[model samples]
Target: MIIGCKDDVLPKPASQLRLDYPVAKYASFSNHCPIEFEINEDAVIKEDKNCEFSIHYPKMKATIYLTYKTVNNDIDNLLRDAQNLTYKLHTLKADEIIELPFINKEKRVFGTFYDVTGNAATNSLFYATDSIKHFVTGSVYFYAKPNYDSILPAESYVKNDMQHLMETIKWK
Candidate 1:
């Protein structure tokens, strides 16, 4: 006689659910083209010189990267650059949707979007792309999913999470 049984998959551990806090205040250089923006995760503020932050949503098994630098000192230039990048991304044919303003100039591209705000300050999201990887820079308040090719169907939760993340960004 032969016996057969069904197989079951186990869930991830509680420890696995928590994400590793990004190395704060570490300045690192990258050969890849640079994108800069600012970050405000509650009371925690991090500035990326040339390094970007990558977060993974295990439940979704999706990975997203947030690359930003603080422009607390030069708000005007940051705004100008943000606008310029917005225009640049507009020209690209991305399967993804990005609601931001930018320009597409020769050898450079730029785009910008406003973060969620209350009465005091507003944050911005920016991106610039060339022949290779798209450089994304901006301020994000909450945990965010990266804009990668994998995520599909674009569910409401993901959208809301992204929106909330953008909204929390503070200029200074």
Candidate 2:
């Protein structure tokens, strides 16, 4: 007697779908300084030790930076202040744009995008400027840049990956 297995009988390994997503292209700006990722539609997820994780797409871009300080310290307060500032920024009129108060005093550019509004995407970006303190040791920044011309709509897969990366962030 001879036994033959079906052509598709072989079991496949668990899917590493998470890692399969497109990652941002890492670029170096200054020597021995913070790394910067070029914001683009293909930049879906990023994981790094020295720098924070950031996602950029056609219609929107989000960044989550891990501060050097621990979360138990003043990070929580800083995040709260950032959130409050975001709320106030959103209250401004559509034609008006203002600086977010929580931004570093030294940095002239506080918020990047304006015209805050809601969308159909599963994940929400800090239309203005928003941040959260991680339980582990640092804080995360979330920023969303939407396309006004409707040239390239942000893909759902990229958005989903961004959400996963944000939710999965943990200190080593």
Best by TM-score: 2
The 10-residue segment with the lowest total lDDT in model 1:
115-124
Question: Residue 150 in model 1: shift from native, Å?
Answer: 9.2
Candidate 1: residue 58 lDDT (0-100):
44
Candidate 1 local lDDT, 71-167, one digit each (tens): 3455456556665544444335333334555455543544444332222111224343332334455433222343333233222233344433443
Quote the positional error of residue 123 for candidate 2 in Å: 8.4
| TM-scores, all models, native as reference | 0.34, 0.35
User: In model 2, which regions exceed 4 Å deviation?
Assistant: 1-50, 56-69, 93-123, 126-152, 155-157
Per-residue lDDT over 1-172 for candidate 2, one digit per residue giving the tens place of the 0 to 100 score: 9998868667888663232345543332222322221233454445454444433343344443322223455655754654554455444422333332223233211222222333211222321112332322222223434332231233344434433433333222
CA lDDT, every model vs. true structure: 0.39, 0.34
Candidate 2: pairs in clash:
71-137
lDDT value, candidate 2, whole model:
0.34
The alpha-carbon lDDT assigned to residue 80 of candidate 2 equals 60
RMSD of each: 14.0, 15.2
The residue ranges of model 1 lying beyond 4 angstroms of the native Cα positions read 1-51, 58-61, 94-152, 169-172
